[model samples]
Target chain A: MTGRDGGAPLEPLGNTPVVILVRPQMAENIGTTARAMANGGLFHLRLVSPRDGWPQDRAWRTASGADRILEAATVHESVDDAIADLHHVYATCPRPRHIVKTVMTARGGAAELRAATERGLKVGLMFGPERAGLDNEDMARADALIRYPLNPTFMSLNLAQAVMIMAYEWWMAADATPPRTLMTNETHVATKGELENFVSHLVRELDGCGFLRNEQKRPGMVRNLRHFFTRGEVTEQELRTLHGVVRELAHPRRAED
Target chain B: MTGRDGGAPLEPLGNTPVVILVRPQMAENIGTTARAMANGGLFHLRLVSPRDGWPQDRAWRTASGADRILEAATVHESVDDAIADLHHVYATCPRPRHIVKTVMTARGGAAELRAATERGLKVGLMFGPERAGLDNEDMARADALIRYPLNPTFMSLNLAQAVMIMAYEWWMAADATPPRTLMTNETHVATKGELENFVSHLVRELDGCGFLRNEQKRPGMVRNLRHFFTRGEVTEQELRTLHGVVRELAHPRRAED
Candidate 1:
């Protein structure tokens, strides 16, 4: 028993962006970040190369009731692997970068993420390490930048602060009851990992059939193909179908050896 | 030098709401709340009857660089004294009260507060103790209520989270995202894979127990079972618990394995 709904269990809010922290330092910040995310109604968390490593006891201690997010959190060795399953990704930085991408305020970025989730796209919001924030290399990979509009003179934002602002916006932008929620939840949309697997499978098939005969342009061709599919939302069943199609195309049924 | 504003003196942002913590328990949280407020560009802080009294070193130490806000913070003996000079007041509560008052989202409330201040009125946003939030008497005194659009099922908000949200909203003032609708559930819905895994586990256990021995009806029984659980929302933790249940039932341990 806890409060008015004393016996009720705590569950995370669904269909929000995947909050990815890139190279985060300090276990306490990660823990506090989880609490902030939970408060703002965000659930999914991905950590790319946490400095002290995952399963830290300090993080659990600080997370309070939000240890559930930490328990379900997935750890990635690289940013690419972290966002492989996502269709859209935005990076949160404190300052402007030289990249030619759309820069959005916290609310604007959150609205965009919410709209994408409603469209069935799995989106991610990435934050850089506490020290220097996101580098240009990481900035180049993101579709856009989410910059919090803090006071110009006193622009002091920690990891938890940045996450909570977006989280608040994400929660507010939602219609509370989404129209496509049931279908989206039921289909159990293919994760970026699943989609990536299918893409790699298709690329391998294309390579075997000489579809990209020009070696110099193969990487660009492959990139185009991946983007074409990555931009679309696919369900688990759809990925299975795509995998089957690629398998059949690569190995004809005429010789089932 | 911090970011691009190194070696520059920081000036407080103008026209933001006053933050009041009523009967706050921890001094460390008071410090962190000041930091959260500063991050969101709000500086005015008022404490009402702090549990351990004022001038807490723990609070100043935990405040990071935000001790300036704490230094300017004023302490009052009661809630009325805290908001005596405020022209408008909004209590941040997690739940709806029996008292009839306009319930505004955090953003909406912030916008309203900004408009009031712009009209040359003092405004205060009050938060209750960490244990049980604002009481009915305290809530009844406010001009309106500001409830965050958090997940209804897991609406566990702390003092710092509430302060940061109001501070962020008041600081932005330009956000146009419509506010005030809260999501229904707290439990995170299980992904398709997690659901499928649970179904497969249950079906396998049923087979082991000879529950699906009938040749013609086995598929129908499995279908019915899957549909029964699939029709409802089961969180990831719930699914894990279900998996454990099936495992235990299939091979019950006599107290221990």
Candidate 2:
């Protein structure tokens, strides 16, 4: 079953390289970070001054089956060392520090990074230790700062969450086709028109069964139901399946009713 | 802080009802289900027919911080026995069967349940065995059917994810207050006038930096950047902070240069 509209194949961008981690604090966070990275097809894992060193047990345990990342991870001793071969790098920070350059929000950062990667530029994202975050000197090493609008009261996001947000945005922009079906396609099991027809039929059957006792209340109740179904964008196959069920219920003894 | 539009306080609805699972299979699934219920503040837990008995060590370990739900869980035998005094009862199913007068999506089901509860109705959501969801006989006793929109290719969601989606939507709508911080009684940060000023300033800054080198490309770039910032409805404090950074960049020190 596809979308309510005509179903179209989802196309997502397949080629985007990512550089991750700089002096990460916890192994579990690194594992989760890898999972988030893998979610968007980002494969490259770079580590700098990890507290527990390479192949840490805690990191693998937290990775939750994203072992490929741990196996492929490249370790470094410094931020500069981590991205020495990269053509471009972007550092994430919540607020302005001493760095004097154009800062971009995560959305903007993703756009710029995608453009760079499309030109075959090796782009890296530098993160700092969990406790104090990236220092001002670290921010100065990057060409751009990636920022996000967060709740001021509590803008401190866990390292993995921050990575996920950036990765998600990059994936959304670079991949023209969605990995998962959006609710906009037409190949769905039932379209809005089909659902309305089925609902009409179902309501008539209910009326015949004398299930809707109050005549005035029927319209409101039916309207509420219609509103509910409309929000879901029921597909064609689902509609047909539902129609078959309703038919059987309407005619209890009929074969294939 | 409150909604950016100066709305009323947004707080959770306390003392939301519990969902009881009877004879559920799989400890991992139960933990996930508990997490889902917790996502939307529906924290009461009751178990009946669990493959493993009450206070299952596996269930608690899987539940993460949702141990509260496991601790508060009550046990029951039959469906009727579980919800005997409840004014409203909903049974979740992927498709319709012989039972259920009203069919609703998880969102609709949760909304209705919330309203009923507000009106002092004791509401209960029931789930049958995992291998086969609620049976027709079991569904027949419920007041309504809660349906979820899912991909036909893989409609089977781990029980908890299903619960989370419903709970999150219910909590979001029921709270009634927006989740943003309000600026003042009548106006919030980034009023239309302020947004306009920021756009003008940003454009000027870009032009000064020679980033707007191409005359034809200027409008599109400026428009895109403006659209990005405006979507966030930048707060007054945020604007002030941004202005300081822009000023510093526009007039950098010789040592920094």
Candidate 3:
């Protein structure tokens, strides 16, 4: 696939895990799921008895240019046939089942999948339908369960979002680039000296305006003020902007427009 | 909202971090974003100059019972008014803007937001429109940039997925329970005594089979075998199952069936 900005050809999305959607209901959701998978670099999508049937127009409409996934999707009759050839299988389940199975967070599961792929093992990640997640029989077929650490009170996740989370984790684990770096391209971070100078100037102006009342409590107040600014990790440019803001706010307006 | 299982009433979804969508273009996307936020226990939805305008029927249709988010949503004419009172503001930006700012991954930004909430600071997470992301002026207003570690080639993410990621991280960080844990509800972790007994039984069975043929490496071989099973923190029932497997394998020719 070409990049969104028409850059170099895009690397294949998730290649290791064959994402099997069991009895997915909504075509739009299936489409979104495909898009999510593509976003995470996951390609192979298998469906098991979709409620609305495959080749739905809405799925393509919602897929938003990721129809390649849908077009290449394989439909299956049962979960057994879906993962019959896979060496490692993970069921994305939220509730506990009757059987005993290894459970892993998405991160741990991705790491385990990576190891399996390195050993030339085909892995499948199964997701149940949106209405009720994987049934007991479906859960029983998997080696382990992968559950997102969601708020217990509100454990429901949009199916595509769930797929996206797993895909994102897998992509992040595979990609070697740092997730983010401090935006230090244009200017340097403010030094302690610069921060202190700005804080001292503000304190002096505040004191002149009687903002720092009670001389005995002045030092503690100043320390608290300094702590607030320091916690923000003010950059040199931001500090200058803050100085300008302070100067404007501190000065009295003498009928100046 | 009641859970899918109709158990307990859900606590209010996101109350701390206000989600502000700037110049949103689509109603369905807005709806799904609401649903995603609700899935992550976030309810506060703020819209800044929505293109299709608020109270669209399509948004409600796609929200999937997350209309509460829309009903209580506050719409503003501008981003500044939307986040006027927030102490901490994070901009979810996929592309770099021509400005100097602090950059953090979604996980790091969530941690920072969690800390700010601990200090009773109100936080606002701003996301730009679908076509064009936040402009330089909008980025300038934010305290930090929350970047998702996405595939460089296919960097575009459906806006709701982005929101869901942040919400999931926030919920996980706030929740005290570990992300993934062994399914230990029915059985306790096998005690050392039980583990030792199983190990001894397994070793005896292996010895009878002449598996440890090399006398020089016998100790290391046994140690390696022990480490393999023990690493999983095998439960009592699992140990029993292993024992059954060993017994069946040891007497292969005596199959009664």
Candidate 4:
């Protein structure tokens, strides 16, 4: 399936679960976070006692075509209520709390969450209130802590921005190896057989140039030359260029001779 | 200089030119754009005719600790007035206009701008009003246009998001390799020497097991074994595990035998 943006194909999330927000404050932030989630092809959203509003007009206005997310946002009274059905719950925190749970960086958390999701586990990502954020009591509900490494002094990230960062990382993990468009126009690297041919050609050129005066040492010298080129992993274009150089040396002009 | 948030040291601009937006429309957007610029350490914000507030109240609020940007904002009037002393001026546009000198992608434009900046040339990024963006007339003032690759259905992006994307690409260019911290922690593959040692051990174990009875084909067998391991790029940990298996095979326990 094509991504919403169409730059790449959408990666299917076989069983990845929703993101749960525990007491999000601003409607605009909710809207933006929803948009960010949509941008990364994450569809599920759950809100717990959002401060300003839920099913908010301002949120709908700011959602900017991500109304589908707003339409599907599940509302709950408390953090526990939001993640009651989840097999795994990850709470986002700036710093570590005294919790006996797996602690992962945002990237690591996303990766693990994605893996769990693929295995058909219901996962939830919990965010807290805008101003004060999640309390220790709220964090007690999580199975893991997702910590973002930011400047300690200025660690406050707007809700949507945080969502975007996590979502982007999840998207990247889904396609860990970036698809490389091969340079079809460029000469392909020579195979082992081609390298052997090039070595033989080079040896003949060296003999013609009187460089291999001693036949016994010629084999050793040729082996060393082959090792040098092999280590370089010379490309087809490079081998072609080397062939030209060898031809020139073997059949030199009278002036050079 | 320290960032306005007074956190980590800001990435140095070296000689990258600054793009000053005069009379920008939204403060939140300005903040977003500033964050974008900060992504690549693109210092020098010159503002003129800001809408919500000068020194950008909303901008700083949304900048997420990029206060140093607000501290460094330089206000200006007309487009020419903003970049009059600068050697190069790149204007951003959603579409190419016949009147503009040239139109380029944010990536292409950034590459050119970076080159010019590296040569100690002053470069300015011109952004027009939000609702109308840069008019063909206003865009004429710039040397080239920086266009973003967006969905054709909706080419528009909030000013800050657009800025952030460009800044991100520029930052990636500044460091061609991913951050060192981002490297995977997988075990190192065995080196040539290590592989040779493992192969010798494997051959001895196989001989002890009477697996290789024909000594005449030993050289070919060894070559084949080397090829197999070389193709796999066995890690040091994997080799150790393999060595244990080989030792077990060579010196079987009395019960197992």
Task: Return whichever of 3 and 4 wins on TM-score.
Answer: 3
**Candidate 2's residue-wise lDDT over A56-143, tens digit each?**
8888786645577778899988887888888888887765543345466665677777888888888888777776778877777887
lDDT of 3 at B43: 75
- Compared with the true structure, what per-residue lDDT tens digits does model 1 show for residues B70-121? 9999999989998988889988877663343467777778778878988989
Candidate 3 local lDDT, B1-257, one digit each (tens): 11343344444643469999999899998998887787677878899999988789999898766777888888899988999999989999887755676788887888888889888889989999877888888898998899887766555577777888888777766766544567877887899899999889989998999998789999999999888877767789888998898889988756765
lDDT of 1 by residue, A171-220 (tens): 77774532111123335667899988989889888888999889999999
Worst 10 residues of 2 chain A by lDDT: A1-10
- Mark the regions of model 2 whose C-alpha exceeds 4 Å error after superposition: A1-15, A94-103, A176-257, B1-257
Top DockQ: which candidate number? Answer: 3
Model 2 TM-score relative to the real fold? 0.47
Q: Candidates' DockQ values? A: 0.08, 0.06, 0.34, 0.04
Docking band of candidate 2? incorrect
Cα error of candidate 3 at position B20, Å? 1.6
Q: What fraction of the native alpha-carbon contacts across the interface, defined at 8 angstroms, is recovered by model 3?
A: 0.37
lDDT of 4 at B130: 70
lDDT, candidate 3, at B193: 93
**DockQ leaderboard ranking:** 3, 1, 2, 4
Question: Where is the poorest 10-residue window by lDDT in model 4 chain B?
Answer: B176-185
TM-score pick, better of 1 and 2? 1
- Candidate 4 docking: what grade? incorrect
Global CA lDDT of candidate 1, please? 0.77
Report the C-alpha displacement of residue A194, candidate 1, in angstroms: 62
lDDT at B184 for candidate 3? 72
RMSD of each: 29.0, 11.0, 5.6, 19.2
DockQ computed for model 2 against the true two-chain complex using alpha carbons: 0.06
